[model samples]
Target: MLHVIVVLAGLCTMGMAMPLPDFYSYSPEAGGGTGVMYSTAHEGHITGIRIWEYASAYIGGIQLRYDGNWTDLVCVNSGTPMEMLLVEDEFIVQVSGKHDSGYIFELMFVTNHGRSFKVGQPSGTSFHLFPTHDGSELRFLSGRHNGWGITSIAAHWAVYSSDNSVTP
Candidate 1:
């Protein structure tokens, strides 16, 4: 029993020594129209998202693509700072904005055990997504509702695998 305890202790230390991968990276886009949809190259649990809005007051909300169709996560016009909505059995984290871009810095995905992981971004900027695709996609508000422009977008997530399990 003493030997087993020692082994387990070593294993736990090894896991702690390893570090999580960087999910999101700074990517800039310009001259894009509003309501432009973007997809990730890989599938993973979305931890958080970061945005840079050009116009503060004119900034609009975001449209998320989950399951099949697009769903409005949040609209700044609603007059709310943040909202958690249930979509197709999955919970979406929506942040509101008004005269500010409402920057979200390092949104972490918490586990059932209270452990948190930093999410990663998609493979590239131009990745496409189909309706049948199981992965989540983000549609930025550009030139919409007073011509609010998204200066930059970064998605944080972890690699999704069938064997991998997560808390709801």
Candidate 2:
């Protein structure tokens, strides 16, 4: 009985030393692999958040957050970014520039979605919903001038609230 007890204790100690498996029943030698912490977001599928700023058509559309930050995105333009409703799987942003004409627009995604855009057309143009290339935080610029502080209500209604209701 003493020998059996000793063996049991030894087994328990060894088990304690070994790392436990994770949610995936992970084992380094399992062959298939432990997989990654965050799945690579499919570039085409635009979920979460997205922002795009326009610049003379030359700056094109800058997608914020994993897309990019406003400071880094439309830095030179100093435009107003307004959050538009998410239609069909995208978060739209309307960025209007204040500068007379000094284009510094950044074309959307460098990898597979960038080139150039229409020049000098950002003042009253509404760009499309920005796409997310990575799986991190997302940001977009907004213009809340509201034509008379009235567009605020419309802007709220356009965005999807955390509770899943259209914001009022």
Candidate 3:
């Protein structure tokens, strides 16, 4: 028992001495593109989007909503962001890239808890994405297998039950 305790102590010491996990380098290439999104804002509900032009391009950031006003939708980067609607409350934007590959579409959700949930590219190389009613779900076109189909949902998640309680 004493020897086992000593070995456990050694293991714990070793575990406490590890380096951090490798992180993705912030590359202009690794991050770009606006995703398909839908968002609610003080101005109203913003929907529908196409590609980009100088009239709406290279503004650093694209369409986004805030708890306050429309002026808060300011861009801060150095390029235009692709814009799209994902749901009623979520807007998708990406940094415009040179190569179409330079930019990527990523989705993030800021829940009531202040936690951010990011929705990103599918593992499959090629596919298309559309919007949903609430922005929490994604409608996609993929050929993950030989012949892909359309699905509004990629996975399943349950947030509430029939108990009629708001308590988590």
Candidate 4:
């Protein structure tokens, strides 16, 4: 029994030493049919984001900058574009949006520094995404985007390890 207790304690300590990613559920897929799936799972920390949106319409496209490299834009760039750059240690803490049966109408990214990037129109069902674990920030994004707009979306959060590796 003592040996088993020691093993369990060791396991608990190991678990505490390594942080894990907190995965929130995906938001509702507003558009019908499965669109092309994309994931921004790269090796560096997120340093910026670009969003393209049609005024009073929907989110048309999105791009993320990881460290110094930018991911390929998902969907089409058919509207006004906005960009947000993060300073060192800044991170996204929340993602709220609105979507309807046909498109994601709005998106807003809130950061730890109290800054936010908001776009698109405000019409449809609402969604708010955030990490449940403290110190975790937006690490990446995964979702399906139709050729026109984002049909579904999800955020991945993690407390980045000291070497900038995503934990878990």
**Per-candidate TM vs. native?**
0.23, 0.19, 0.21, 0.79
lDDT of 4 by residue, 1-168 (tens): 999999999877656533432523233333433589978776677899999987678888999998889998888888778999999989899889888876778889999999999888888888898877766788778888878888877887777666665455
Candidate 4 local lDDT, residue 104: 79
lDDT of candidates 1 onward, in order = 0.31, 0.27, 0.27, 0.78
| Tens-digit per-residue lDDT, 5-91, candidate 2 | 999998676454221221111101111111221122222222222233442342322233322222233222334443322334344
**Between the candidate structures 2 and 3, which one is better when assessed by TM-score?**
3
Model 3, residue 43: displacement in angstroms?
15
lDDT of 2 at 15: 52
Question: Per-residue CA lDDT of candidate 1, range 21-81, in tens?
Answer: 3321222322123344443332233333322222323223444433344444433333233
Weakest 10 consecutive residues of candidate 3 by summed lDDT = 141-150
Candidate number with greatest TM-score: 4
Off by over 4 Å in 2: 1-44, 47-61, 65-74, 88-168
Top candidate (lDDT): 4
User: Judged by TM-score relative to the true structure, which candidate is superior, 1 or 3?
Assistant: 1
Model 3 C-alpha lDDT versus the unseen true structure: 0.27
